[model samples]
Target: MTTTLAWIDYLIMLIYLAFVLGIGFALKKFMKTSEDFFLSGRSIPAWVAGLAFISANLGAQEVIGMAASGAKYGIATSHFYWLGAIPAMVFVGIFMMPFYYGSRAHSVPEYLRLRFDEKTRGLNAITFAAMTVLSSGISMLAMAKLIVVLHIFDAPFASLGLSSEWIFHASIVLSAVIVLGYVYLGGLTSAIYNEVLQFFLIVAGFLPLVLLGLKNVGGWDGLRHSLPTGFTHAWVGMSQASTNPLGVEVFGLAMGLGFVLSFGYWCTDFLVVQRAMAADSMTSARRTPLIAAIPKMFFPFLVIMPGLIAIALPAVQEAAAQPGKAATATSWPSKGLIPAEAEKDPKTGEMVPKYLRQAGSDEPLLDANGQKQYAYDYNLAIPNMLLHYFPTGMLGLGLTALLASFMSGMAGNITAFNTVGTYDIYKAYINRSGTDRHYIWIGQLATLFGTIVSIAAAYAAAQFNNIMDALQLVFGFVNAPLFATFLLGMFWKRTTGHGAFFGLLSGTAAAAIFQSLTLPAGAGPGIKGGWLANLHTFPSEMAQNFWLAIFAWTTCFLVTIAVSLFTKAREDKDLVGLVYSLTEKPREDHLSWYKRPLALGIVVLIMTAALNLIFY
Candidate 1:
C-alpha cells in the first residue's frame, strides 16, 4: 500500500504547507473586528465565495469516497452530484438566499431565533456546535489515517526510532496545527481563500490523473467495452431496486437523496451557508451557490474517471476474458492496485493477506467466486490511481492536492464551529453583553478551542471508529428533519417556534426508529441497522440511509404543519424580510440576465438535466 516519494514530492508538500500558512498570516491585518474574523467582513466576491463553497465540502469524502463510489457503482456515482447537489444548490441560491442574507442573522441558528424563538435556536446551535466539532475531528482522523495508510511518514519515524503508531498521532497533530494556525489567524477569510486554493490544487492534481487514466484504458470506448453493461450508463436498469448498483429505485433515489438529504444539507447546513454569508453583497450571496453549481455539474468527469479506469484496467479485462467471470479476489481491485487488508506472516515475520470484513460483523465478504473480496480499502482508490499514473514530480503534486483536501475540510468545519460558537452559543447564552472587541477576542479563543477539541475527537475516532461512525449517523438523524423546519418557517408565516422544535425531535425519533427496524439486505444487526425487529429489509445500506431521511423529513414536515395550526403565528409586520410572502422579492433588473441568480439558476438546472439524460 505504501509508495516511495521522491525529494520533489516532499518539496511540493512543504511548499504547499508554506503557502497555506502564508495566506493566514498575510490576512492577519484584516482581523481587527469580530465581523472580519468570523464573517470575512462580508467582503468576498461571488466567484471567490462560490469556489470556496464547493471546496469546503471537498474533504476526504468528496475526493476519496466519491472516487471509491465511482469504482464501486460506476457512472451512477454522479447522481450524488448531478441529482443530489445541483438542485439543492440552485434552490438555496434563488429561493433561500434572500432570507439568509436579508434577515441579517449572524448564523443559521441565529436565523432560527429570528424566525422562531430562542429555544429553537438554542437547540440547533448546541447540537450544531457539537456536531461541527465532531465532524471536524472526524476529518482530522481521516487525514491521519490516510497518512498512516500511505506510510507517508514511515522513513522519518524509523529514522527517529519511533513506532509506526506515531504516524497517526503525528498526522493528526500536523493537520490540527495547520488548520488551527490559519483559521485562528485570519478566521473565515483565511479559510475561504485557502479553500479556493485547495479547489484549484485538487483540480490541478486530478485533471492529469483522469487524462492518464483515460489513455491507459484506451479512452471512453475501451472503458465502455471493458466495464460491465450497466457500469457505463448512469440511468440504465435504475427503475427496480435490484437492477442497479445503487440499489435504490428512482422514487427512492429522487425523493430521498435528491430531496430530503440534498436539501437538508445545502439549503440548511450552516457550513456551506457560511461561505455565502461571507459574500460582500446580497447579489454576491445569492450568486455564490449558483456559481458553485456551474463546475459542480461536470465534476464527475474530473474526479471520477480515474476510478472507472482503475476498475477497467488491463488486468481486470484479462480476468474477465472468460465470459461472465465476474470480479474475483485477484481481479476485484484491478490486480491489487487497490490492496487487500494485510497481516503479518507469523513464521516468516512477513506481511500476509488480511481479508476484509463485512460492515458490523466479523465475517469476511466473499465474491461470487467464493474468494474473499479484495480491498475494502476504497479510501485508496484515488490515491492508488494517482500513483499508477504520476511520476516523481507529478506524484508529489497529486499527493499535495490530497493533503489540501484534508485541510480544506478541517478548516471549513472549524470556521463554522467558531462562528456558531461565538454568535449563537456564547453571545446568545454565555456573554450576551460583550463588546465587539471582546467578542472578537472570544472568537479567536473559540477557534483555538475548536481545534483542540477536534484533535481530541480525532483521537477518539481512532480509538472507536465504529462508535464514531454511529455518531455521524446520529447527527444525520438530527439534520434529516432540519430542512422541514427551514422550509416551513420560510414559506409559511404561521409556523411557531414550538412547532419547529418538537417537529425536529419527532423527525429525529422517526429516523432512529426507522433505522432500528430495517436492515440492509446482507448487513448484520448493528450500525447497519435492524437492531429493533428487522421488520423491513432494504436493498443496500445507502438505501436505508436515504429512506431514513425520507421518513424524517416527512415526519417533521407534517408535524410542523399540524402543530402550527394550533400555535400562535408571528404578526406580518414583525415577519418582514424574514418570511417569503411578507418580504419583497430581491430585484435583479439592474443586472444582466446571466448575472441574475434566477437566470443562472435556470441555466444550471438545464445543464444538469441534460447531463442526467446523456448519462442515463
Candidate 2:
C-alpha cells in the first residue's frame, strides 16, 4: 500500500517551500507599518491581486471536498463551483467592489462600524475571527490527512513503526508551523506572492492527474459507460429537496441564492476581500475581482472532473470489494450504509453495518454485500486516488500542489485575521496612539495568535464525523445571517441601527434552527425517508437558535424601515462618498453603451442554464 517518493518530487516540494519562505523574508523590508503588513501598502496590481484572490480561496478542502462531492453526486456537484460561484464574481466585480473599495476600510467590520455602530462592528469582528480560525484549522487538518493517505512520508517513517493516526497528527502540526512561519514573516505581501507561485504549481500538478485519469478511465466515452445513467447531467442526481431547503421551491430562489451567496463570499468575505482591499486604487480594486472571475469559471474542469473520474476507476471498484473499504455511492448520509451494518450489534451480538452501529467502533469490517466499508471516512477518496494513480515525478508535483493549496488558504485566513485584529480591535480598544512600528508588531502578533487558535480548531474538526457536511452546516448557520444583515445595510439605507442589529440576530437564529433541527443525526432529510422524515431528526440544540436569529433579522429590517419614515434621517452627506453614491453621478450625455459586463453576465448565465438543461 506504500508508494515510493521520487527524488524530484521531494526536490520540487522543497524548492517551492523555500521560495515561499524566501518571499516572506524578502517582504520583511516592507513591514514598516500595520497597513503595509495587512494590505501590501495598497500597491498590488490588479492581476496579482486577482491571482492571489483565487488562490487564497482554493484551500485543501476545496480540492478534496469538491472531489468527494463529484464522487457522490457526479457532475451535479459542479453547481457549487460554476453555477454558484462565477456569476456571483461577475456581480461583485461590476457592482459591489466599488462600494467596498471606495470606503477605504481595513476590514468588513470597520465598514460596519461606519455604516452602523461600534457594537455591531465588534460583534462581527469577533464572530468572523472565531469562524475563520475554525475553518482554517480544519482546512489544515484535511490537507495533512491527504499527505498521510498519499504516503508522501511513508518510507521515511516506516522504520519508526508509526501508525497512520500518528502520521496524521504530526502532519497537521508540521504543516501549520511552516505556514505560520512564512505568514508571520511576510504578512499579506508574502502570502499573495507565494499564492501566485502555488497557483501555477497546483494547476500544473492537477492537469496531469486529470489527463491521466481520463486516459485510464478509457476516455470520456468509457467514463460515461462506467458511471450511473445521470452521471454527466448537472442536475440529474440531485433531489429537489436537497437543493432547496426553504420549501419556496422557486427556480429563482435556487438560482438567486446560488448567485447571492457566492457573491457574498467572493465579494464580501474578508478572506477574499483583503485581496482587493490591498489594491492601489478604486480602479485596481474593482478590476481585480473581475479578473479573478475568469479562472474561477474554469476551476470545475480541474477540481470537480477528477472526482467524477475517481468513481469510474477500476481500483475504486476493486477496493470496494475488499473486506473494509466501500466507496460512497450517494451524498445523502442515510442513503449510504451505516456503521452498524458493518459490525455486530453489541446488544444483540448480531453483525451490523459500521455506520448503523449505535456506538462507534475502532476496527473496520465489511458490509453484508461483501464490500469493504469505511463509513466514517469519505473525505479520504481524493488522496487515495492520488496515491494509486499518480506516477513518480508526477507524484511529487501533485503532493506539492496539495501543499500549495493549504499554504495559500492558510495565508489568506491569517491575513484577514491580522487585518481585522489590528484595525478593529487594537485601534479601537488598545493603544489608539500607537506608532507605525507598534502597529506592525501588533499585526504580526495577531497573526501568530490566530494561527495557534486555528491549529486547535483543526484538531477539533477531526473529531467530527463528516468534515464537508460540518463545514457547510457551519456556513449555513453563520454566513446566511451575516448576508441578510449586509444585504439590508447596503441596499436599504432606511434600515436603522436597531434594525441592522436585530436583523443579523434573527437571520443567524433562523439558519441555526434550520441546520440543527431540520438535519438528521446521521442523515439530512432528503435521504432519511423523504424530506419530512429527515427533518424530524434535526439536532434540537441548534434549531431554535437559527430560527430566532432569522426572526430577529426580519423583524429588525421591517421595524427599521418603518421607523425611518417617521424619524429624522441621517445626513445624506455622510453616505455620499460610499459605493452606492455612484448612482448619484451625473449621467454623461455622450456615454457609450458597450454593455460588456452585462453581456458577459448574460452569457455566463445562459451557458450555465443551457448546460444544466441539456445535462438533466
Candidate 3:
C-alpha cells in the first residue's frame, strides 16, 4: 500500500517542531544554578507538573506498545492503566510526596542515602543511572523503527533517492539532535515545559483517529460484538490465569501489578516523581500526581483504541492468519511478505505477489525451520490505522505527535539520568564539594554522555519482541524489587541500611532466578537460559511479568524484615523527615475540600473504579 502525505501535513509538522524548539530556547535564562537546571528551582505549578508527569511516561513504547496490546488482548489491556498505574499514582500524591519533597533530596538515590546509608545509595544510583540510559536507548530505537515502519519520512527520503537504512540512521540522529538541543540548554525545566506541550499535541493528533476508528468499528457495542469472547470485559477472565487474557489470576493482578509494580513505578521511579518534586509548594507537590492520575485514567481510550479498531479492519484481519489456518472472507496476505512469482489480481489486473494472493496465503513469512512468524505484528496496529483513516494534514499532525512523544520520553530519561549522575554519583563519590557552576557544567557533560550511551542502547533494543515487552523486562530486573526496599525504609524504623541493601540484592536475584526458571521456549534477548532449570511455563508474557514482580517484592519484603532483626537500626533523630514515624505531619491548610489531597484522591479512585466496571 502507498503512504500519503500532502504539503499541508509537512507544514503542520514543521510548525509544531519550531514551536517546541522556541519554548526550549525561551527557557534558557532560567538555568542559573544546578538546582534550577535539575529541579526547576522547585517553582513549577501543580497543573503544569501534573501534565508533565503523565507526558514523561508517554514515550513511543507507551503509544505504540499499548495499542499493540489492545489489538492482541482486547479491552483487557486497560489493566496496565487502571490496575498498574492509577492506584499507585494516587498513593504517591497522597502519601509519599511528603518524604520526597520535605526531605529535599536532589534524587531518589540521595533519599536512599539519607534514610539508609551510603552503601544503599550507591547500589540504587548505579542501577538507576544504567537503567535510565538503557531505557533511553529503547525509546530511541522504538522511534527510529516506527519512522521506518510507518514511512513517516518516506516521501522526503524517496525524493532524495535514499534507502530504508538511510531512513533509519537519519531518524535516529535527527531525534537525538532535537532532544539534545533542547534538553541540554534548559535542563529539567525545558523537558517539563515541552512535556506539557507534547501532551496537548498527542491528544490533538490521536483523539480524532480514535473517534473516526470507533465510528468505523460501530462504537462500543460494535467492538463488543466483533471481538472474540472475553475480549470486552476486564474482570471476567481475571479469576484464574487460564481464564484471563493476561494469564494471571485476580490475586496476581491485584498484588503484583496493583501494588508492587505500580508502587515501584509511580512512587519510587524518579523518572516520574521528579516531575512532582518540582511543584511550587507542599500542597502542589502533594497534588501533582493526583491531578496526573485523572488524565491517566482515561489514556487507554487515546492510545489503545486504535489497536482494537485495527484488528477489526478488513486488511489486518486478512493478514493475521496463521500458516495452516483455513482462508476466510476477511483474511488477506500479510504485508511485506510477497514472493517473486505471484498471480494477477482479478479486479485491478495488477501482478499480486504470491504470498499476498490469497486469504490463507500458503507462502507465509517463516523462519529457517519453516515455522510461521507471529499471527500479526501488533506493533503496526496504530500506524496502519493512522495511514488508512487520517487525511493529509491530520496525518502529519499524528506523525508529529508521535515524534513529540518519543522526544519527551527521551528527554525525561536523560534529565533523570543527569540529575542522578551529577548529584547522587558525581557529587557523592568523585567530589566532596563543588561550586554551583561546576555541577551545572558537569550536568551538561553528563547529558552528552547519556545521549551517546542511549544511541548505543537504541541499537540493542531491536532484538526484543516489542517495545512493551522490552520495558517490562527491564522493570522486572530493576524496578520490581525497588519498592520493597523503599517501603520498608520509609515505614519501618527497624529496617537497617544493611538489611535494605542486601534485601535489594536478594530481590533482584529472585527475579533473575524466577525469570530463568520460567523462560518461555522462544524468550527474547537479555533473557538467558541455564541459570535455573525451566520447570514451569507462563500462559502469557503479561502473566510472567506480574508473577516476576510478585516474587521479587515478596522476597525483598521478607528478606528486609529478617535482616533488619539481626542488624542495628539507625537512630530516630537521624531519621527525621525520612522515616514516616519520626517525621511530623504537615500543617493542614484552610483550603476547601476539593483542594485537599484526600478529597482529590477519593475522586480519582472513584473514576478509576468506574472505568474498570465500564470495561469489565
The true-versus-predicted C-alpha distance at residue 246 of model 3, in Å, is: 1.4
The per-model lDDT (C-alpha) reads 0.87, 0.67, 0.83
Off by over 4 Å in 2: 158-166, 236-239, 242-260, 316-377, 463-475, 515-517, 520-568, 579-616
Summarize candidate 2's per-residue lDDT along 377-402 as a digit string, tens digits. 44545555666577778778788888
Model 3 misplaced regions, further than 4 Å: 161-164, 316-374, 462-475, 520-531
* Candidate that scores best on lDDT: 1
- 33: Cα error in model 2, Å: 2.7
> Model 3, 4: alpha-carbon shift in Å?
1.3
Across residues 1-616, which tens digit of lDDT does each residue of candidate 3 receive? 4567878888998898787788879989989999899999999999999999999999978998998888878788899999999999998888889999999998888999999999999999988898888888889988887777666788887788977679998988888888888888999999999999999999998999999988988998887777787878888878888887777888878998899989998999889989998999988999999999999989999998887887765554333322222334333445322112335557888544343222234555666797544345567777767777777888898888888889999999999999999998999999978999999999999999999999987876665556546454655677789999988888898999999988998998888888878854245324533245776666666667788889999999999999999999888899999988988987656888888998999999999999988778
TM-score, every prediction: 0.94, 0.82, 0.89
Rate residue 121 of model 2 by lDDT. 85
* lDDT for predicted candidate 2 compared with the true structure: 0.67
* Cα lDDT for residue 604, candidate 1: 96
lDDT of 1 by residue, 1-616 (tens): 3366777888999999999999999999989889899899999999999999999998887888888888788999999999899999999999999999999888999999999999999989988999988988988888887776666778778888999977888888889999999999898999999999999999999999988888877889988998998888999998999999999999999999999999999999899999999999999999999999999888999877777787776543221211112234343333324544456556887554566678777688888898776544555678778766777899889989999998999899999999999999899888889899999889889999999999888888878978888888889889999999999999999999999998999999999999999999877788888887899999988888899999999999999999989888888888999999999998889998999999999999999999989888
> What is the alpha-carbon lDDT of model 3 when measured against the actual structure?
0.83
